[model samples]
Target: MLAPSEVSPRSLHAVSPMSSPPSELTPRALVAGGLIGSVLAVTNVYMGLKTGFWESGCVLSSLLAFGGLSALARRGAPLSPLETNLSQTTAVSVGAMPASAGLLGAVPALTFLGTQPPGWAVALWGVGLGTLGVLFAFSLRRRLLEEEALPFPTGAATAELISTLHSTGSAYAARARGLWVSGLASVVLTWLRDARGLVPAASLLPSTVRVGGIGADGLLLGIGWNPMLLGIGVLVGPQAGLSILLGSLVAWVGLAPGLVRGGLVQGADFASLSSWLLWPGVGLMAGAAATSLVSQVRALPAALGDLRRLGEHGEGWESTAGQWASRAVFAAILLTLGMAWFAFHLSPLYFLLALVLAFPLCAVCARATGQSDIAPISPVGQLSQGGFGMVAPGQPGLNVAAAAVVSGAASHTSASLWSLQSGRLLGASASRQLFVQLSGLLLGAAVAVPTYFLLVSVHGLGSQALPVPTGLQFKAVAELTSHGLNGMPPSSTLATGLAFTLGVLLSVGARGKLARWLPSAAAMGIGFVVPAYYAVTLCLGALVAVVVGRLRPSATQTVQSAGAGLIVGESLLGVLIAALLALGFLQPPG
Candidate 1:
């Protein structure tokens, strides 16, 4: 049924036809990517822990790399498009370490379960799992990216941005200036609020609102003075942002009071409410993600065909898996299984089962991300947990660890494919990008592993400051699997079931034109887990973007750059604040 046009080799180079290979994989590009990735590694750990959302560093990294490299190029060698892609790819790889390392979810869930994994164990586990995912990307690049012609919107956007930046001399400088100006402004605002105590945590809101006998503070309703959330709102657009807002209002304003009156929630604080709300939230996310994955079943055979023909093409490492690529993949499997055996004490059976399941799950993740820009990372982990719960039974630790491996691999697979999508458009060497991405993985683990521990030590997991909502979902799933709803409130169980059904229905309805008008179940689920203020700010950010676009369409990208700067600026500042608190230079907020 496949068309000859789809399988033609020339289609691979349709975007960029070069007479000679460009200057890619340079030491400067690698170093630039490594350094930027180190910062992103730290930034993402802070952002992921606090908000349960991590930004892709590609666009921001592209601008930064271009700005820096272009500056130096004026006096020396010129920068090439492929070289910039390599740098951005490397930076994204490093920045994505927090998720791949399980710091955002599973590993933190372990700590909550009273098992603190050593830094070395966590690092090794991340590298092994991430390497497996990267190998999957390597194997499927030609098929998914070249043959299938998946949109990969993020990659296309990045590629377009790169071409635009390089085409005009001043374009990069202008965007870079906007990025840094907004970033520096965010840094200043964060310092004023967090460090110097000059700004209130929530700027524009009433202190409290009383519903019946329950008094709700603006902060409790999730209104806060955080630019990062607003920035996220801008990036995600109106549909998701508004969905989150609706979810927040429904969860906090509508549900919290009823729970308080029912004596289900003992207090109006975030911790008290989220403990009960997370059940329904987690259920909704699970249902929607499950539905989404099932929708991709039709593509499995094609994905498998690609997997089967991974090394058959004789186009070297770019289009085919040559001897070196095959050896590396085998090595990656060994490293992953070895880490599973040594670090988590997972038996070969469980590890291999997870490995087998990961291919389909990661394939679904990649395709889903390409089609809809949603990676389903959390859903992938929960699915793993459910599988292991049945197989292992009564071993919550094993369930959590197994889920961690699957999610970690999925995360890396998604990230790798995104980079490869851009590379294909730029005619960059897939082999070289793979090498750079792998290097970023190592560098990120090295820098971010320590930073994760430091932030946890200072902020404390499950605290109001670092709620680690994603981790709580993982923890909730593991516990539920072990105990089977023993001691759960009857009301909470009813709510969870209803929410799950609703999520499934919404997901089923979110196809084609209806998708734009429908509420995003995943965003609603996230809104239920995180504080309400994040939703409010995210909506506001989206509003700003919408208004700006209508006023001047040309300024849309500038707004996005500014929003990205806001996120990066505040995230890096949060990390710095954590370090200061750890070193006793700054006191914890009273």
Candidate 2:
């Protein structure tokens, strides 16, 4: 890693504007960005709905947009470095737009509510919430990116890639080619497992392997080909990867078998196992993340002070261009409140409470995202649900949906900042980048809202085939808060408490002396909710990353880069496959 430069605090830009000649944010750049962002929005939505997590689009979008735009430039296009920045900024912003309200966390929870609003309402919510996220984040650009110099890793990476592309385009071709190969391989692997149906899955196993009443399939012990899971594991690094594996063992070997043998759980199917197990996983993760987030509250005063000072000085917050930005933030939020109250028939009082909680939560999400690329959005969503479960009791729809208002904002705000960071590094126009970001969000919503319904039609929400894990967690929290432990078995409740405590201890310990050895509490907790097969694949990927890092540290970046390619390729292919399935052009193997 390059050492931190002792850049002056007044240097708001990551790269000097005079470092190289600035290029136009051309019409071609805007269109390419919108198109790329739309495609990535579809891909990430598809991937996230399936896995309950998503890779950041900035790096992938930067690489792809630069290459594609550069190729066009060689022929007839007039793309410039700043234009590539504009394109990437737009792509990352809009591509993840739907995630603010529709894809990952909130809309899917509506499936569990069993009474969803019409599609158009949801589409509008995506746009409004997404825009609010950008507005909310724009105000903090100076505080977080400029004054704090927080390492938005993915943002930095994307910026570095853009800088590389602009300085010398030929050097990028090798990395791009490697990315393509991994992506193609990932698509083929997914096809073989799911569509081509090459892999044989058997429930029965020999006596030695089958312990208690749990069979091999019951434990989900067999490996399944999912390149995306593996790639994600590699990106997360070894500690997190190993933690995931450890969590998988805790579930499949101990929890799954024990539940079956003790007659606590009724079935061995994926849905049956995951539904019961999700509670503890959700709790563990939420509890740990909540503790960590609350601790950051201590630093808020200093950060806020810095922000105020910047505004006072006119060098940071107060600006000729972004001065009226705060007004826009208020307007967008007010519009969001109105939309929530009228369109969805949400209680104005209850929705307002959610809105009040959103700003701080959004800040925390940004802090977490800046520090580590992992945004603990699911846990934060649960935190919102738990808070409001009592505030708006027994109203599952309001509970999940209202929380979405904040979690969505928090999540997308950090996402937009990631894009802005890239823009900063490339010396792109901040105001114009903001404009493209908002525009990309609109484009993402247009594409993503429709894709969501298509996926729902093909796989059906809440099904094992396309389990929206984040939504399920939200649904579970809503139910748990409203019902308490009345519906659950005593053992289940006890187990959940134990897991939660374990999560607390682990996280707190990590914060203290045990920081180095222990795995990420969040990753470990996630293993409890997802299918064991996913954990296995993730572990495999992590294992590969670890081995390579140990044996050949220099090539680790190359491998990780390739892994990223695999993620993008598989996601795009997955979207295509899902589309074909929805259209009845491709029959999923019966």
Candidate 3:
């Protein structure tokens, strides 16, 4: 029996007070929750295509899904932490997956399949990759959750949103209204700017905007003033986001123009520059992962010890339902993997190699990121599929790519489970959370797959066709495949390296005085790898965050909610407009 002090409801204002946890969600509530989850998922996916990790958008989506669910649950039945976790997990998964669309993995799948892979293939891949990710993440959750107390800043934000909405009904209503209004307005402006290609008056601002520079067809490249993104820049603060912006300006505005003027680079030069950005991004991710793993090594023994204790407790952590669900998802994934292999006629040995490599890689990466719960099994999926470009050479098809997808999905599943386990520790019911999570996974996968196809068919992939501003995606791939680090102009690389070293020193040295600048290491590292434009954008976001935080002394939760609302609203609207353009419901302005 849990102690009353441990589990009883305290004051309503208490962050995690146990007032029946928020009531079990009603059927109506579930449907609404799912729909909201779907929207959030879609929006985040779209944003993810722009920013690696989908960042604040997905975080916000999770918050909204949880907050809305909690609010509705008050009227009917209260939801357990398990249920809430499941819903949030599913929604997050949906958004994350779609972001991977049209990348190397999805591209091969589409090119080879000539259409979307069968439902079974997608399901199998999804389940396999998700599960593997979760398992890998499980190994590290104790370390990340307990020892480090890594502020899952986003998760904390979600919890606070739920608490606030529940405690003050009037405030909740007002915020919701504001969100909708802002969202709608953003949607309209995005559609006009992106789909219709309207030349806004802001474009005429000589200092703030530039119009008609050279682009693909010798047509003038039109640039418009983006106050929203600029506002986001302000919120992200001057440090990180501004750094990214400076990098972007240097690459796109400074270097690109210089090259063009000198006749040293041309249309094709853009591709080469993109390659430069990508490798740095890859290196940064790898380094970050490596660093995280090294930091958490001490906690490994304790985590493993917990597993031993769990075993001694006669599988106390295991629920029959959870086991069954896990098995079912696993079986489904296996069957799909088999079918995909059969369809592609892949070498069984290669397929097995890819499948086997996924788990260890995911586990290692997960441990490193302190996200041991989401062990990143899918990155292996990316690796395997990308490797297939070499393994199969000429045969770029669904068979190889689907294998990677399976690996990715398994990783994702493991991550979700880790998240669920965290909820359990915090006093959530297991069964309810598991069920909601499973439901969410299914729903997210179903919606996201179609959305991926829709987006790619309409917008075309990569920076040239899509509005996703250039970043590490193209840059890293280019560096790995085309130019090695040696390709970086010696002076540029030295400058970046020096800056990076200084960033590290500053971060390490200014522990108390400039704590907020720590994330700038990531920015510097990312800046080194990607174009100056993307670095600038990130810096912009960081700046925006800092300014807003200072200006509004309100709780962090309220500010994050507003920021999240802006991100989701703008991103979703962009997608809808993209879809309309693809369907010929709208046309680009001449």
Candidate 4:
């Protein structure tokens, strides 16, 4: 954690163009950063849709964007201090937004209406959702960013990457070479799988290997080998990763297999196994939300105050005559919300109800979670969808989808605020940070929409699609509404809820055995919900982290930095490959 007073105004002063700053960022650097960020954002979102870890996309995107920006900034270029910081920060933040597109579009689209709405409707929802996120986060800028001193782990890694690049300028060349090489390899591999229908040659275990007299299938092995996801597992730590893996195993290997053997689930492929994994994953997310809010309640007021101050500052910048312009923006936001309803062909009254519901939900959730900055805006879009869903059960999908977008916007806003505050604490300018963040958001959103549609088209929708390994998809969840909530067995719900509750208790209370092992609970819960293969890979990551932690106890920061780099690098490469394949510019080898 860092404090506002610890950040000096002098630190925000732009570095002299003559003297090479710690990181000499330039236009070229910005371009490179943007490209990398875009790739990471796209891939992460793609994977998130396949898997159920929506947050992973944003986290990985930020990391990769920062890494690329830092690497480029290390090389000497004609850039002032503010330019360097703003460019790097903005580039990374932009990547975070695209990963959120599904939430911004698909969730709301499906939730407010019965089917997928038009692109314009989705876009308006995205804009309003995004704007609200920024506004809400702005309110808490002071408390979370300035007073709490919570270490912006991702931001710090970015800063360190920049420093490392500056110290060894040649390192940028090495990283670039690595990125291109890995990217080409991934692209080629993916193309071969898609076009030629070629089977991957590599195998972690023999295809014929049997477990408990059951012959292992190629699909099982293929599902198990998600390198990009494994890399993320390493970053999330052994405990959380292992938990997710275990959950997957229970669903895919234990439950799905057992059900099939017993003649209960009849499908040859058991595609519905993915749905089983989703139940717990969703529960975990809900639990996390509830628990986080409860824990952070004390900080709510301060966070809200900071946001209010920021709004005041923005208003004060203009003369009284021009103050009306600010009001016009707010009015515009309202009109846009109305337009979204019209575009979706929904009743205006229903739309108004959604807005009314959003106000309190956002505020209350934020206050509960101690993330007042994001809470203020997140609930509006989601609650609106929920309200609409209740009123129009025929269109539950659209309503739920809308809710997910609201969640993403809120999450993104919080992340941005955190990043900005980190920069401020380290002596960066507030205005510059804001500019960079806005730039990143716009660029990310522009790229995300097409990328999302492309993935759905290429991979297929629902359970038929190739999973993105570590990503989550709200639209897919929304689709589940067609089956009804009763689709989830009561026993399964109870079991998952109990497990999650016990985990939280262990984390917050109990001591000895439970406490010592508490760190692993999140992973286990996640594993219980994900595929067996993913859970296995996550476990591998935990193993690696544990080993590293033991080997260099004094280098925790270093280990974390390196781990962050691997996660971001691999994830970014995956997204870029997907994008290139979609564009027909790069073909995977058949």
Candidate 5:
């Protein structure tokens, strides 16, 4: 039998009793949320395509909404804290959708398969699938939030921030100040690095760091002084950052030169080299991920049990299937099935499997986020491909597309819970928050749909300007497996097998005592995939944080906050530059 405390409504992060009813979710606020969400969603797409990572829309949305509401307050009327939460809840739901790993990452990868889907299809597909995610999130809320009490660090931070900001309208000043300073610094540095037309470029380091006449690039190199990477490294922590470094060294130093010298590969460039190197890196990472999941098989049944007992509380949307929102989700999922069949040519069986898989995959993604604030989403899509390909073989397009839907839905599903967790803590109406999230999704689709196609039409999908790593992965795996392994290159097959074996051993070996020294197999795999410049710059940030955190542990939050500001700053500016270049307002700088 379960303990009473385990199933109780009480929580370490539960809402306090309120004296007054929380402020209303007004039309103006809803519109504001949608509009803001659209901008953020566009930014997300731009950044995701550039960096192959998507930062949370929560903190940034909260910060922007609070500032806007505060500014409006100075003039005349202002939003209450609850209203702010509603607005932000809406913003994050929509903001994270457009450039979602599932849609922008997995779907756009179809370009490699000679299948470039239209923006309307992508948009409709995203909104429909994302709606299912929102529904999945709420249904899991009772277990994940109330009973099980997962940490959900981002949600907690946002909740505390909303409470603090509303209660005293003062703390935001320091955080905002930190945000802008770093943001502006990043913008300036990016312009200099990208647009400053210097001969041989404005590199912060000297040409060579020669050790025994081999040169560090040959010996696998040191860190780069890049702001965006530094920010990510700091955010991901030293261990993950270092693992990326190790992966980069193994690929570039230990592997690349030998491959080139032996005439196994043609180019030494990041883009060229990642094609071959990332195979093993991805295999290693994928193998580790699969092993980690398989190792936890005993816990699966209990999680499913917790999930099925969702509405036992006899309250909220889950308990009442009569709710319009509930019906909307059902309708969306059903309609999406039709869309998949006619538009995407996916089979009906794949949709059923995607739904069944959503329960477990969604749980995994949400729990992962709650624990580490990182969601390994692409693997879910990959897993979907692997699972479906066996039962229904040779339909590569259908398999990958179905996987995209599942992963895409899972993305929104996990994200919605986090967005609403803050709202619930702030005493916003559950129905209202749900509505806001849905509205944001619709608005995000409006913006993201156009932005995606525009970027593709102007810049091209696989272009160096936008080297979407996830898209490449989705494209590669779908084609490789579905098209038949017998037709694959001999070298590629050997490399993948070797990499998979290496990944399994290293990951499995990282038990108990050996954990800290090894770093994340996933991060190392990413290091193999992305540019050396990215990994190098990230190391710099991680190194700085490690050094500073040890010296001044008290100020780590402030520093991390500033690092976040740098990321947003650089991302916004980078998008602006990309847009300008696309429109012919600015020519290629380098």
Candidate 6:
């Protein structure tokens, strides 16, 4: 979720290098990065479970590495920029595990379908997918980073932040301190609201108002109390925030009452409503994703050309990473294939097809990330699911698992390439970065999956506390594909078809001159699945951000830093509360 920075790659390197560059892969750097990355991995899992979004912790990780390394440098050797870059790269890789390892989307979706795999298998599967992404990044490093010189704004910004921090005194410390302070505030707020029960969980709409004779008592409508949703609103900007609010209004206030009055959907809680709502939501998301991919067809020619070049100079590509790296990538491919067969009972042919589809899909994700700073990861997964649905029809497990391979690998590729972009600017060794990133992937999977298990144990999937929006989307798609149109209620089927067409139209409209006028089809679709309270809180946060930006533009970055802190802090605390509940140390509130 790193916003695209306008900073040019060349402009960042204008600053002078260090008098003496440090080692690229020091033991201290590795250990520190592993620790911070592990924390980040946990935070992302918590955040993804709650909100279905995760941030790439590159800038935050860089600041953290600097803070820790600077403290260590006081007694020992001075801090080195290259070493910090490597550490941040490692941390970024590990931090991205929730999305890249399928913990957020695919694995959870399978769990929802009553097919939870063992923790060890999940970890191995994640490592395999993540390593596959690192391989893909290695293959494209020359083309995307060197030959084409894509800006990769996030990477460029990290390089700039590192340079700025090293050159200027007090700036990095101030920013890092601000992050901690913001996080502390979030921690206290979450504890007070969730643990002590001093704060209300939600604010309900006025009961006097009626829509189709369904008032506040008849429909679940309110503004939630989670600071994380507000933080998400701030980070996502007004467009996406408003889009989610729009979707919530359409789904809850508009559609829910009608569905209930017509007896199409039963119950008022999130679970019962989402069971029916997920159909249109998933359809809308898939339609938008397909349209977005189609819009990128122009990149297909250049992509094919890049592939042709890669085929022609395959040896040169191997020379960049060396023969050992090649062998490792092969091992990763084999690991993925083996895990698919052993863990998920996925057919080898289907798994291979997912990988075959992954090549182009990874390119699509990378290009989207590079261009817009928004990797269409969910959409990419939808495309994969759609393909598998066609070939391996009526197999829910195969559909979800195969899409997991594609989405997980693509997510990793996007993250790694951006991290490599920072490395490219700082002149760090590509091979070393690759090695550390691979190590980080394994470390991330080790921590994130278990944390997920702990949360699910306490909160349970589809609960209000852990809606798992992305998981619901994936599960909905798998069910729809396996059962076709005959499986759903007639009204729901009609809604899904209409939502799909609307999604396609909205996505198509966003590509042209009126792009700014359109809402994000994806975020709106997400709003359909999450509670209305979340959307209300998100909109309020977005409004607060807009007011601050207009009143004090200089504080925009400060606000964003705080927003990021709010997300991480509350999520970490939520995880702690979950653990405490699981251990019988904390009781669930009445």
* lDDT of candidates 1 onward, in order: 0.80, 0.73, 0.47, 0.49, 0.69, 0.82
Residue pairs in clash, model 2: none
Provide the TM-score for each candidate, comma-separated.
0.93, 0.91, 0.71, 0.74, 0.88, 0.94
Model 2: lDDT equals 0.73
Q: Per-residue lDDT for 1-590 in model 2, tens only?
A: 21114333223234466675546578778888888888778777877887776766777777778888877788775666678778888888778766786577677777777766667777677777777778767777777787778878777777767667667756476667768888889878767766766743222344357745666765667555677777887877778878877887887777887777677788877677776787777767766866776666765665455345432325542475466665576666766777677666677787778877776677777777777666766656777888888877777788888888887777678888888777666566678887887877778778888878887887788675577777777777788887777776537787778877887888888877778897776777777777677777778888898898799876765677677877777777777778887778888876
State the TM-score for model 2.
0.91
Give me the displacement of residue 296 in model 2, in angstroms: 1.4
The order by descending TM-score is 6, 1, 2, 5, 4, 3
Q: What 10-residue stretch in candidate 2 is worst by lDDT? A: 1-10
Give the per-residue lDDT of model 1 (tens digit) for 175-233.
Answer: 77667888999999899888888877764344555755566573365457888877888
Model 1: runs farther than 4 Å from truth?
1-21, 203-208, 317-321
- Candidate 3: list runs displaced more than 4 Å: 1-26, 55-63, 66-86, 99-124, 134-153, 170-178, 199-239, 257-264, 268-317, 325-333, 339-348, 364-422, 464-541
The local lDDT score (0 to 100) that residue 190 gets in candidate 1 is 91
Instruction: Count residue pairs with overlapping backbones in model 6.
Output: 0
CA error at residue 104 for candidate 1, angstroms: 0.8
Per-residue C-alpha lDDT of model 4 across residues 496-583, encoded as one tens digit per residue: 5765575566446423556445544444545544445555655675577678779977544444444445444444555555667778
Candidate 1: minimum summed lDDT over ten consecutive residues — where?
1-10
Candidate 6: regions farther than 4 A off: 1-19, 206-209, 305-322
Error of 5 at 29 (Å): 4.1
lDDT of 6 by residue, 258-358 (tens): 78777887765567767888888877887898898887788877776655554222455347565565567778989988889998778789888998888
Off by over 4 Å in 2: 2-21, 76-79, 168-171, 199-208, 302-320, 371-374
